[model samples]
Target: MGHCIICGTSVDGVVCRSHQEDVAFRFTGNHPNQLTPGRFYEGTVDGFADFGVFVDIGDSVTGLLHRSELDRRLESLDWDEGDTVYVQVTGVQDNGNVDLSWSIRQSPREFRGEVIDSPEGDRLPDDEPTPTTETEPEPEPEPRTADESRNDEEPEASTNGGSASVEPQSTAGPIDSGPPERVTVDALEESVGERIRIEGRVVDVRQTGGPTIFEVRDETGAAECAAFKEAGVRAYPEVEAGDLIRLTGEVERRHGGIQVETESLKPLAEADAEAVVERLDDALEAEAHPGEVEPLAEDPALADLTDEIADAAGAIRRAVIESRPIVLRHTATADGYVAGAAIERAVLPLVREQHDREDAQYHYFDRQPLEGEDYDMAAATSDVTRMLDNRARHDEKLPLVVLVDTGSTAESRDGIELLDVYDVERLVVDADPGFETSDVADGVVPDDGSITTTVLAANVACGVGDVRGEIAHLPAVSYWEEAPERYAELAREAGYGADAVRELREAVALEAYYQAYEDKRELVADLLFAGDDEVRSLASHVSEQFRAKLDDELETVRPHVETREEGDVAVAVLDTDAFTHRFDFPPTALLLDALFRDLRAEHDRLVVVGLDEADLQIRSTEGIDVRELAERVAERVPEGGVLASGVRRGRLSFLIGEREAVREAASEIAADLAA
Candidate 1:
C-alpha cells in the first residue's frame, strides 16, 4: 500500500510517475493480487467543463464523460451550470481518473469481469511459460536525451517557408472569443434616451396632453409609444394600440420608471396585421348592427319625462285618488257642464281687474262644500293666510287647481265666513270648471290635493291658482270624451299633452305613496317618540283609509285591467291613470316588501321578483333605503333565489347598488358549492 502523492490517499498500486507530454500517470507501491477490469458502474455527472463532464461513482475519484461522447442531437453540447445526467464507467486508465459513457450499447453485466487478457487480447495459457536462462539482448542503443526528444517534438520546417505551420491568426484576436452572441430585440438592455429596439403587444391608444400614445407588445414585454407633438399618430394612418409596430428612436424615461422616447416608428405588419384585420372585422360587424352598442343607462320615454319633472320639482308629488263614479242621473247636466268650462264663476263680480297697490287683494273660493267633505275651507283658508304672510306668495307661484262644478246646492256660505260684501280683489279659478262646487270634486281631485285650498281662497289670499288640485282634477274619461277640445286646449296652455297629464298623474300616485310612507314614518316616529299605542292606532287608521282609497281607485281604473301577483304583492300595471287615482310609493314599497316576505314564506324560499320601472322604485324610496332593501332581501334569498332589478344605468347597476350583500351571499354560495 502506498499514498497518492497528488491527494494523499492510500492505494494499492505500483508507485510510478509516468508523465508524458500527451498523458500522465501515478501509481502507489502496492500491486493487485487479483484484478477485476472492464467492470461498469452507474455514475452521476458531477461537474461540467468546456472539454468534458466529470462524474462521481461513489469512489473518492471521479470519471470523465467527454463532450465527444454526447449525443449528436446536442451536437454543440453547451451544458448549463448545473445538470446531472446518467453515465456508465467505460475504462480506467493507468492514471487515477475513470472514463465514463452514457451509451448502453454494451450491457454491463454481460461484458465486464476479471481481467484475463491484455489490451490487445493476448491470452496467457493455463500454465505459465517457463523462463529460459536467456541472457537479455544487448541493451538497445542509449535512448536520446530529453533535450533531443524535446527538439524532435518541434514543428518540422516547410520546404520554402520559415515554419511548417504558422499559428492561425484570429482577425479579432482573443476578444472575438466566438462570434459575438446574436441578440434578439428582447435581449437589448433598455436605457433612457438610448436608441434600442423592443417589441410588445399593443394594449391601448389614447391622447395625452401632448400626443397620442399606443401600446405595443412582444414576447419580452409591453411598451408605450408616445407620438409626440403634432400627433405623428396621423402619419401611421390606421395604426392603433395592439398593432405590432417596430419603433426606432431615442428612448426617454418619463413619469417615473416608465421608458418612452420615439422619433420614428413603423408598423411590423406581419406581427400585428392579423389583429388589425380582426379589429376591422369587429368594427364592420358593429357597423352592421349599430343599434346594439348603446350605453347601458337609458330611460324609457315615460320614465325620462318623470325624471325630468322630478329633477325640476326637487321632490315630486305623485298621487292617486279614487272617487265614486257619477251615475249621471241624467245627460241633461252634461251640456251645462260643457258650457261651464268657458263661463266665469259668479265671483267675477267681486274681482278687481287691476292691482295698483303693493298689498292688493286677490279673491278666490271653492264652492264645493267642506262641512262634511274631505276638504275643510276654514282649514284651507288658514293655510292660505299663512301663505299670504310670505311676500313671495303669488297666483302663478301656487300650483294647485280646484275642479269646480255647480252642485244643486252651494256650501261656500255654510263653511266660509264673510259670505259676501268683502273688498273687491282678483280671483283665480280652476281651468276645468266642470269640477265646480260638487261632491264629484274630491273624487276627481288627486289624492295628494286633498289638503289644498280652493281657487277662490288661493287667488284672494295668495295670488296663485291651485292648478294641481283644481284644473288637473277633471274626470279623465269625461274630460277626454265630453270635452276633448277643452281638455286639449288646457293641455296646450299648460305646455303639455295627455302624455304629460298621465305622467303628472303617475307622479301624483308616487307622491301619495310617499305621503302614505311618510304617514307610517310619522306614526312610527310618534310611537317611538311617545312609546304609546295612540300613534300606532293613527297609523293603522290612516293605512286603512289608504287601502280603502286604493280599492276605490282600483275599481275605477281596473275596468279593462290585468294583474299578476307573486305573493301578497299584486302589481297591477294599469294602462291609464284611472287605476287607483295615481301611483303612490309608500304603500307600494311596504306592499312590495310584504309581498317579498310572503313569497319567501310560501315558496319555502323567495323565487323571483318582477318590477316595472325598478329604477323608479329605487329612486323614489328615500326611507327603507334601496341599498337596505337589497340587503334585507339578499340576506333571506337562497343562493340562487335572489332577484333584484334595475333597467337603467345598466342591468348590473342594480346589482352594483347591492354589491356588499351580493358579495357576502356569493362567498357563502361558493363555499357551499365547493363543499
Candidate 2:
C-alpha cells in the first residue's frame, strides 16, 4: 500500500479512489470503465448531429455529446471537426454508447489535479501541502509554486500554442494561497463596509442594466454579489449558476440592505465541489424558514388572526430570499396609501437586503392602488402588461401581487382570476371579512372591523422585521376620520401628535388625487414618517390648502343641494358635475367622504347621491341599501337604466335619453316617503 498525495491516507496506489478524479490521468488502460464519469477529459470534435456533437475521446472510443447536456442550443456550437474540446462522461450504457456533456473549462490543467503512472501504481505530480506548527498562531500561507498556479486562477479554456489542450503548464504564476477569510452571507450585516471573502455556490445569475448580480448561497444564508464589466455586458463571463466560487469584495451597506461589490471571484477546484454544494444545501434547509410570528402586543385581537399573518410573513420572506418581486395593489384613498406605503417601507429594506442593486427596491417591490374600492379587470390587465414587459425586457420573475384594503370582496374576482391565469402569487391583507377572499388569494389576513389595513400591513412588516421603525405612524395616518386606540398610541409613541396625524391624513388624501396615477412615494413617506422637523411644515401648509378648497366646494354645492325627507330618513342630492369643480382639487370621492362625516352625527344619512352627467355615486349610511334605492329609481323611470352599478362602490348610472324623466321620478319618491 501507498499513501495518497492529497490527504496522506494509506491506499493501494499513490492516489486514493476518493481523490483520483482530482488528478487528470492520461488513460493507459483499454477499457471504457477506466474513464471517470464526472472528470473532465480531453477530446477531439469528430462531427455534428442534429441532436448532438460526436466526440472522439481516445483511439478506441467515441462519445456522443448530447444537446440536452449543453447550456445553449446545439446549433450554437462553435467547435470545428478537428478542434479539441473537453467534456464529462455523464453515463456509459450497456451497449458502450458513451453519453457526454459539455464542460465550460476544456483544460484539465486549470484544475489542481495531476496524476501519472509508470511500472508501479498511480502517483500524484506534486507533494501534499505542509502542515504548520500548532503552538504558534497560524500565519498567512506563502505563495504557491508554478505547479500549484491552479489554486488562484479561474477555470476556463487553457491555451496550448493557440489551441485548446488538457496539459498543465508553468506559464501562469501562483496566486494568493492562504484560504481567504471566509464569512457567511448572514454575517454581512455586522461586517458592513468591511472587506471580506465568502465562498459559496452560485444559485442564480441575473444581468441588470448596470451590473451582473450573482446570488451566492453559503452555509449561513444567501445574498447577491454584484460584478460590473460594462453597460449591458455580463461580468465574469465564465461563471455560471451551480459553480462553487470564492468571492472577494467589500460589504457595502446601501439600498436599505447589504451587498458585496466583488473585486475578485475564483471558481474553486472540483476536489472541493462536493463539500461546497453539501454545505449550501444544509444552510438552505436550516435557514429558508421565516421566523415565527407573535401577535402585536398592543392589539390582543390580532391573536385571532395570527395564522394568516404568519403565512403572509412567510410568503413575503420567501419572496425576498427567492428573488421574486412584490407588487402591492391598494385602494386609491388615504387609508389605501397608508397600507400600501407601510408594506412598501417594510419590503424595500428586505429587498435591499436580499439584492445588491441600487434600483432593486423599485424592481422587486411595487405599490399600485385600485381606482376606488374595486380592483376590476382593467387594473389586472394593467398589472399583467407591466409585469409581462418587465419579464420580457429584464427577465424578471413574476411578482407577488399583494392586495391591501381592497380585492377582498367578490368584486375583484375577475381581476384576481386574470392574475390567476399566470399563476401569480397573490396575498390579500384586508380589514373587511365579509367576503370569501381566501378562495382567490394564496394567503388572506382578513379582520372584521377590528383594525385598519395599515395596521394589518404594519403587523406583517413587523413580523418580517424589515420596515419596523419607519412605518410607526402609518396606521394613524390611515385614519382620516378616527384612529383605533391601540394604533393611535403607537403613532403617538412614534412622536406624531393627534394634530400631526390629522395633517398627514389630509395631505396624503389631497396628494393621492392629482397624482392618482403614482404612489406619491417620497412625498407620502416624508409626511408620514419623517417627523415635524422635515415635513410637518409642508403638511400644515398642504392641510390648510386642502381644507380651504374642500370648504369652498362644500359651501357652493351645499346651498344648491336638494334635501328631502323620506319616512325618518333624510336624503341629500347634489348635481356634482355642474355645482362642484370637476377638474380641481378635492375629487368627488374625498369631497363626499368629508361632507358625509361632517353631517353624519347631526343628520340621518339615508344616502348622499352625487349625480354627474349620466353617472351617480351614493354614499349611503344608516344602513340604507343603495342597491334597493337604485332599483326603485330605475322602476320609477322605466326608460332610465338607473340600476345598481357595482356591489362595492355604491354606484349607479342613468341613460342620457331619460335623464329628465329620472330627475322627475327622484322628486316624486322623495315626497311620497314623507311621514
- Measured by lDDT, the strongest candidate is 2
Put down candidate 2 lDDT per residue, 1-675, tens digits, no spaces.
666654555677655544443445544444576665644566789999898999877656788988867755677678899887877676678888887875645575644455654334455545644322223344575564452354346432211111111222222222233244678888999988666788887767876433567888888778888775543357777776666787766687544566787756667655555677788666544454445665444676576777777678778876776677888888878888888887777778778887655567867788876776767799999999988997777557788888888877777889998999999988888876665656777654555566677778877877666556667777877876778877788778888889988988888888888768787788888777765575578888888888899999888788877777765666777888889999998888778777777666767545566777887766656433445667788888877978766544556778978876776565445333321
RMSD of each: 37.5, 16.6
lDDT of 2: 0.69
Residue 388, model 1: lDDT of 44
State the lDDT of candidate 1 residue by residue for 488-543, as single tens digits. 45444544445433433333333334322121222222311222455435434544
Clashes of 2: 0
Against the unseen true structure, what C-alpha lDDT does each candidate score? 0.32, 0.69
User: What lDDT score is found at residue 31 in candidate 1?
Assistant: 24
Residue 55 alpha-carbon offset, candidate 1, angstroms: 78
